[model samples]
Target: AREAGAPAAELAEITEATAVALRIRRTLGQHRVREAQLTALFDTASDLAALRDLDAVLRAIVHRAKLLLGTDVTYLSLNDDAAGDTYMRVTDGSVAEAFQRVRLGMGEGLGGLVAQTARPYATGDYAADTRFHHTTTIDSAVLDEGLRAILGVPLRLGSRIIGVLYAADRAPREFTAGEVALLSSLADHAAIAIDGARLLEETRAALVDLNAASETIRTHSEAMRRAEEAHDQLTDLVLRGGGADDVAAALADILDGGILIHDADGAELARARTGPQPPPTPAVAASR
Candidate 1:
């Protein structure tokens, strides 16, 4: 081009203009990617907010992670802090049982490193990565699943690291910084979903117990109301100079059972029977 006699200063200006154009194009592309990722994060938040069932929420998280990351496999592990390990809780695009059930100690493997540090970690070829502590069990599962490239991000709740979310590919491919950021954003959503689901479950259980206790209290209150009404009725009868037979009849009607009245010295005064109940014996009436 220089030999073709295009002006040298013009060529320099054109080259610089071309470089500026390339940079602009690259920035535009990056902006589009970030916009798409932000949209995905919003969608994930909306989807998770509507779900109350824990299992359903977890399934949705893994599915969304797989979709947004466009990885061959995606999975989530929940931290069992009491057990001192993070265990696989949900998976998508996984065919290996061993891989699906893999568990990692708090500081083992790439996922464990995320859990331990509460940050995002990625590798183009996990088997050769020296930045993470590898374990036989995790390695075996990765091998079984045929995963080469892996990205793991911490699922966090406030200051607590709750678990790890992963996106893995079968072939070695370096994950971009944008991809890591995208996955980290998704991981934040997943953590909120899990924590919120558990809280909802607890709330539902509490509501059930509260409802049951309320029913018991209502039943007892109803019984007490009937007793109060019966007492007031019997007192009115006495105030009106009604006889013992009046008392016996009122008691029989209200109790739905045979009634007996006795005077002092164990002498039977009156008896009433209702509903097919056998008449009270004289001995029973005298003893009342």
Candidate 2:
């Protein structure tokens, strides 16, 4: 059409119109991508919400991350405050055994950087990235897994960094802004799931403790009631003219131990014993 002697003004208008059409198509494609991201986030939220176990929730989060990002591997690491480091918690599509159990010190690797700073970090080529501190163990794991790209986001709970969520690819790939946002969304849900499961476990343990205390209190109360009844009965027997012998026998039966009553002159007035007999002594009776 351009070679058919078209007017300059007409050709310019056509070119502009084509450019506008391309722009509209690009905008529509972007919108579709955003829509898919939202849908995936919603589904992930649903999936995490239904999980009650801490391990199960973390596993689901990584699995969803792998699906949404289409990555070769996904995993989560939790911060160990006592150790001041982060350790691998769960993984999806990961074949490296050492990587699954690797621990990263604060500011050590990509996940460590995220945990220390509580921010997102991405690298198209992890082997060449000098922005993070590389350790022999982490480097070995990454190399073994053949991972070149990495993106990590902190699992933050009220400004406190508890852990990090990561999506990694086997080959070099630049993660886009949309992909980052989606990852952050998934991390938010994961944090909630983790915190919720922990709280529930604590509550259950508290209830168990409370129940044990209640049982103890009940047993003590029953024992106290029986002791009070025994005290009343013993007092009534004495008031009804029962002698020291009766008191000694009754006390021995109740205490399941030896009983002896003495007079003012240190003479044994009454004695009762069902089991091993305690040797009689005039000095002991005087003291009693």
Angstrom error of the Cα, residue 123, model 1: value is 1.9
Q: Which stretches of candidate 2 lie over 4 Å from their true place?
A: 230-288
Tens digit of per-residue lDDT, candidate 2, span 41-98: 9988987899888888888999899999999999999999999999999999999899
Number of the predicted model whose lDDT against the real structure is largest: 2
The model with the greatest TM-score is 2
lDDT of 1 by residue, 77-127 (tens): 989989998999999999999998888998899988888888788999999
Q: Candidate 2 at residue 169, lDDT?
A: 97
Taking all chains together, the TM-score of candidate 2 against the true structure is 0.79
In model 1, where is the ten-residue run with the lowest total lDDT?
A: 273-282
